[model samples]
Target: MRQGRRTGTTALLVGPAAAFFLLLLVLPLAVVVIYSFGERGAAGGYSPAFTFDNYLSLATRGQAFLNTLLLAPLGTLLCALVAFPLAYFLAVKTSPRWRTMLLVLIIVPFWASQLLRIYAWLLILGNRGIPSLLDLLGMDGVRLINTRFAVLLGMVYGYLPLMVFPIYVSLEKLDKRLLEASADLGAGAWGTFRQVTLPMSIAGVATGSLLVFILLMGEFIIPALLGGGKVFFIGNALVDLFLQSRNWPFGAAIAVSMVAIMLATIALYMRFMLGRSGLRQQALV
Candidate 1:
């Protein structure tokens, strides 16, 4: 009777979440997968027919794939590079008062609309903005907006807080005794950080990187607003296919392909990070 009750309680707790996941996520994905195997209708939506032509035609959007593959990782890397030091400073260097205030400042941006923030960046990087400032310094013909650089800048700016908070949490929870031990062994500042601080905080770095990279994969708004259509990502391609061209089958195929790629990449990343962490633990032991 107790076991039965426990099982019932477990099901009660998990049933809602499982149903929500299936109803929203899995069902939609299943529909998309089905649509991907069908044909484009006479009008705009799907038609009941099975074919591989949609998948085969993915080559036409190779540039979109290339751009997304390159930019997403690059943007994630840039976010990690910029966020690490800031996170470290907040977790280790700052006093409690300043840390709280600075953390609030970091998080305040997120409360605002992402579109509005990107639009602000659009203006800042426009011809009359930074380029004009550079022209004042004799760097004429300096274009900031509508470029890959602007897209990357926007991505880094938009995603930095996501990267920082994860790393900060990791570093904050790190054992201070390890640092003291490293110092007691006559390790210098750099040595202590390298041996103790960095390795200990690797979890945060991995978490932050994963968060930033995954989001960057499906990013459209940043590139759209900042790149001004000069740079196209897979997300943009999907938008065009489904909305503009009304090629539902092809769009579904692209979406499915993107999901596959992201899944594979994430699997590889998790495996690598886990292996590295295991090796580090062995070395520490």
Candidate 2:
């Protein structure tokens, strides 16, 4: 009787959330799947007629796909490259007192709206900012804004905190004695890092990379603002489809395809990380 009561209580606690998830997430997704098969109406909304044209039309946004595919990974990679070192330093090298302050500093910009922060970058990278300084040094009209470099820079800056926090957590929780043991076995700093540190931090790296990659895939505001409407992504395409063109069915199709691609990429990444982890375990043993 006591066990039955306990089980009932547990179910009661979880029941609302489960119901909420089913209603919000699962039901909506089922609707999208159903809609993806349906036809676009003459006025542009879902219709009952099933067709594959929507999916086939995915090929039409090839450039947007190509751009998103290229940039998202590249942006994630760049963020990881920059964030790893900062995280490593904060986790392993920095004194605890300074580390807290520095970590706070890293996240300070996030207290402001992201739009505001990106706008700040616009000022910094604009012709009046770095380019003007360059002009003083005899270089003229160094155009930094509205370029791919600007987009990349904005992406790296905006996402650095997200990347750093995960890595910091992983590295902070790391077993320091392992590094000592490696040194005891005559492993140099770089060798120890390659063998002990990097391998151990794979979870954090994977987490940060996946987080950034998925977000970057859906990113549009950064490209629009930083790239000055020149650089386009699938995110931009989707925005146009829904907001500008009001093509609800086509927009739904694009969204579904984007979700599918993100899932596939994340699955591949997880598999690769797991394989690497297995190899690392073997090497350590």
Q: What Cα-based lDDT does every candidate model obtain?
A: 0.90, 0.86
**Compared with the true structure, what per-residue lDDT tens digits does model 1 show for residues 1-285?**
999999999999999999999999999999999999999999988998999999999999998898899999999999999999999999988999899999999999999999999999999999888989999999999888988899899999999999998889889988878889999999999999899988888888888888889899999999889989788899999899899999899999999999999999988887787565773342221
Clashing pairs in 2: none
Per-prediction TM-score to the true structure, in the order listed = 0.91, 0.89
Candidate 2 local lDDT, residue 83: 95
Cα lDDT, model 1, residue 132? 92
Off by over 4 Å in 1: 1-13, 279-285
| Candidate number with greatest lDDT | 1
Q: State each model's C-alpha RMSD to the native.
A: 3.2, 3.5
Candidate 2 clashes: the total is 0
